[model samples]
Target chain A: MLLDLLNKLVSARYPLRPPGAVKEDAFLQKCIRCRRCEEACPYDSIKMAHGDWGLKMGTPFIYPTAVPCYLCSDWPCINACPTGALEAVGEKENVKMGEAAIDETTCFAYNGIICRACYERCPIYTVAITLKEELYPVVHKEHCVGCGICEQVCPTDPKSIVVFSAHR
Target chain B: MTRFELHFYKHLNRYRRLIQILSVLFIFIVPLLNKAGMHAIIGTFYSVSIGQLDIVDPALVLQNLLLTKEIHFPLLLAGIIPLVITLFFGKVFCSWICPFNLLAEFADKLRKKIRPKTIRAKNQNAKPQYYWLVFGSIISVAAVSGIPVITLTSMPGLISGQVADLIFYGAVGMELSIVLLILLLEVFFWPRFWCKYACPVGAVLALLRGKNTLAIQYDAHICANNCPVNLKKVSLCNAACPLQLNPRQKGIYPYCYNCGACIEACFNKGGKSIWFTFHPQETKTNKSGS
Candidate 1:
């Protein structure tokens, strides 16, 4: 439909939404773009989408490489959302911002560099990421909340481990 | 002007400027307070919370209702406060509280200063219906596309949001450029263009005015009988209006935000022809030429 095409055209990038964000379509519909979530984040992890984001301008997103969500236990961002674009989940661990994937070709650990940066930095270490044969770090996608702490801490120059947006 | 009237009218604009400046400062102060571990008051103009009370933009709430196809009671409740204010006060938010309006006023002054010979064009003042048309188009586009498009264009929301962003993140986003671009156009080309003809936020607020709402009332008899100024030329009230509206006419009420600039101008010009009154019936003047 024409509406779908317009939505697609305006949504320039599927940037990682903040914790407790609803589905992208619903989020767009409900979000009034108040920037309350941005103000609530203690780590300043939430950022307002700017002009480059097309119609998504004023909506909140997180560029985890620069400042990853610390994933506060209280979910202040969700509490700050007045429009219900961000709903309160039962547990912080249940937050599914996106899923993380590691590129074997660029990964230092895969290239025998023995990097444990991502595994060590993972908030849900044992569940989200595991040691493969006691050397490689393997991501369990279902368990990974995609907070992007691993991407922030990745030793690789281009970030071997990246969190892809849940919607994408 | 009498000594007492002079004293009073001089302070009217001074009070307005104080409120305008305070609102601008409020945006930055809230973020700084939030950073200092305070959570009592928060958010930008799009929506804000002062303790347990959530005050949201009525236009955004309307957009949300259209796009989501549901009634959100909390947001609806939050939106009512502004609607009630606009219902009684007649878009005072634009003149007294909107930071963008303060910036636009400065831009209008600068435009006059840079080009002193600039003449007021007849077409400069857009018809009120055009503002409604723009508002309707925005709402329709938002409903169809399932996007809150007004949030992208709302100037007050953008200004407050960017201010918070600057305070928290230590840098403003590219969205500030949109404001800058509008201001550039305001300075160089059209004066009071966005608020008069384009802003959906103002359009919605202005439409909420009732017959009893605070509005600028003009006494034609005072101007026709008592005024020494030439009626053929631009009167002081018309000259004082930032939106270039003829305050003497009732038709211009929709475009008027009860800024009282013209009222102050009339007082300064030694004529109490124009003033704000909630009860328009008591101050009803003769149906003469505007």
Candidate 2:
């Protein structure tokens, strides 16, 4: 119980950048902390990254739970960035901030309780998340853009299904 | 209007306060104003833009330069603009526009009212940490992965961005809790703790202004001649200083933001001895008396 609590507390749940974030090193160098990306995000998903991340402080990021990106068709964040820190990647599928992975031990469907929360809410639907026996969810790494809708919609407390930030 | 009727410093103080309030308002409105069709005004304290023009924080830019080992153009411009402003203005940003100072002023007022008279006396033990923080950040950034860690302690930039975040994005982070904790500290323990001593940004502004001549000038001859008895008493200018600085002292230039409160106090006390000027004055007078 204590370990579970600690895991929830200290988990590496770093916020994912908007649709068109460059690699971490380039992003840090390129971003002027203009906050244009945050402002352009229609869903209010983007927020300025504060001190906790050290040097990336005042840069833009999106916490999925607070407000997940609605994945607008035009991608306003990329367009708003004047510094090219966030490039205009062509498609929603092309912009991979991170990938959603399931912890089967805590997932209700895996525990025979029958839940398809992640599979139902995933942006890519059948491709990103698919149902096993038409019930338990299985995440396909290639199809998942890590928009974080699945994690946001996850019914399980401590989120059985969570999106881990993409390793640049 | 006649020179006597004009109330020069009073109007200046009012203007400074107006700018400070406007800056705070600008941060609050940034997200609202920045939209798809109306991409007119955007950014927070770290950076800001009006149309195509942009202003970036020099300290953050310098940190990025140290870390990345490559010079970026826009960020360099952002960093240089503030440094240039600090060059002519001499830490006027702290007095006229820092959003954190507005919050601190309110907190300081509450502190003054709530705390007893005995404890309200400015503690003499408080040492200025701005220099150490500035240098320490540089050393640490070089040693620890080249990323500037100074922003972690930068109250103005951090809080302004966070408050904007909380209002526009409906998001709050650990920094809010940290700010609240500091606010609590400001109210009870030490007044003007962060601004007077700790802020790295303020340290950078002070260093940039290094003996640059623009400062609160103390006319000792005038004070010595008129109201010499009042000069022996606790100075109104010293009491008016939010940073607990003696405006009459020559050494106060480096730390004096030219906030004009001291001048206001002097005016209130029926003396116009203290005033802002760009002329270099004698440093010897600072050692003479309180």
Candidate 3:
């Protein structure tokens, strides 16, 4: 449908939305681009999409490499939303921002370089990321909330582990 | 009596300027307060929360309702304050509170300074309908696209949003350029053409007016007999209007934001020809009855 195409065009970047963000199409419809969530963020994780985002401009997104969501006990961003664009998730662990993926070819651990940075920095720790034979860190995708702490703390240049937006 | 009227009229613009400055400052202050660990007040012009009271732009609310095809009580509740304000005040937000209007006023001043003798072509007759057309098209585009496309063109929202971005992120976004481009156009080519013809926010607010809405009322008897500017090519009030509207005309209501600029101009010229009336039509009826 025309609506579907327009939605896809606007949200083409599929930027990592804040925690408890509804589906992309619904979020675009509901979000008035107020930036309350961006200001409400204690960790400065939420950022408004700029003009480069076209129609998605002013909508909240997170560039985890610069400042990853700290995954606060209470989602203040969701609470601050005037519209329900960012919905409330009952439990913090239940928050699904996106899913984290590790590129094995470029990973330091895969290249025989000792790196446990992502595992140590993961908010969920052993649940989201675990060491394989006490050497390689393997991401447990289901447990990963995609807070991007691993992507932020990753030692690799291109980010050995990255969180792909779940909405995409 | 004349001196008192002049003093009172002069203060309207002064008060309007003060409010405009404060609204601009409020945009920055809210973010600073939030950064300083006070969440009591937050947000931009698109939506703002002062303590427990939330005020969302009614245009945004309408667009959201259309796009999502859902009834959201909280969102509707947030939009009521602005809706009610527009109903009574008749687009006063466009003149008084909108930071873009304040900026456009400066642009108008600069345009006059740069080209002092240039006579602006008046197209007042065609503007209100054009503005409504623009508003209608934007709403239709929003409904079809299933996106709140109006937000991109909402000047006050963009200005306040960019200001918040600057304070929070220590840098402004590319949206600031859109505002600058419009301002550039205002300075070089058209003066306040955006607000007069294309601002969907102001258009929606202007459309909310009824007979009882606060509006400019012209007293023809005062103007015809006593006004100093009557002999001049253009009356003081008509010349003073930023939107180039003839204040003496009967149908300037929809385009006029009740800014009192024309009223102030009339008072400055020692004429009591124009003033604001809460119930314009009713006041006329009462005068005839008496």
Highest lDDT among the candidates is held by which one?
1
C-alpha DockQ of every model: 0.64, 0.24, 0.76
lDDT of 1 at B222: 76
Cα deviation of B222 in candidate 2 (Å)?
A: 1.8
Residue-level lDDT tens digits of model 2 in A39-107: 767777887766566456677787887677778888877866655577778878787988889999999
Arrange candidates by DockQ, highest first: which order? Answer: 3, 1, 2
Candidate 3 — which residues are off by over 4 angstroms? A1-11, B1-7, B120-124, B282-290
RMSD of each: 3.0, 6.0, 3.5
Q: lDDT of all the models against the reference?
A: 0.84, 0.70, 0.83
Q: Is the docking of candidate 3 incorrect, acceptable, medium or high quality?
A: medium
User: Which structure is stronger by TM-score: 1 or 3?
Assistant: 3
* Clashes per model (N, Cα, C within 3 A): 0, 1, 0
Clash pairs for candidate 1:
none
Whole-structure CA lDDT of model 2: 0.70
Ranking by lDDT: 1, 3, 2
Q: In candidate 1, how many Å is residue B188 off? A: 3.5
Q: Candidate 1 docking category? A: medium
How would you encode candidate 1's per-residue C-alpha lDDT over B167-262 as one tens digit per residue? 877888898999999999988888788988788898889879888999787888777888767756656777778888777665666788888888
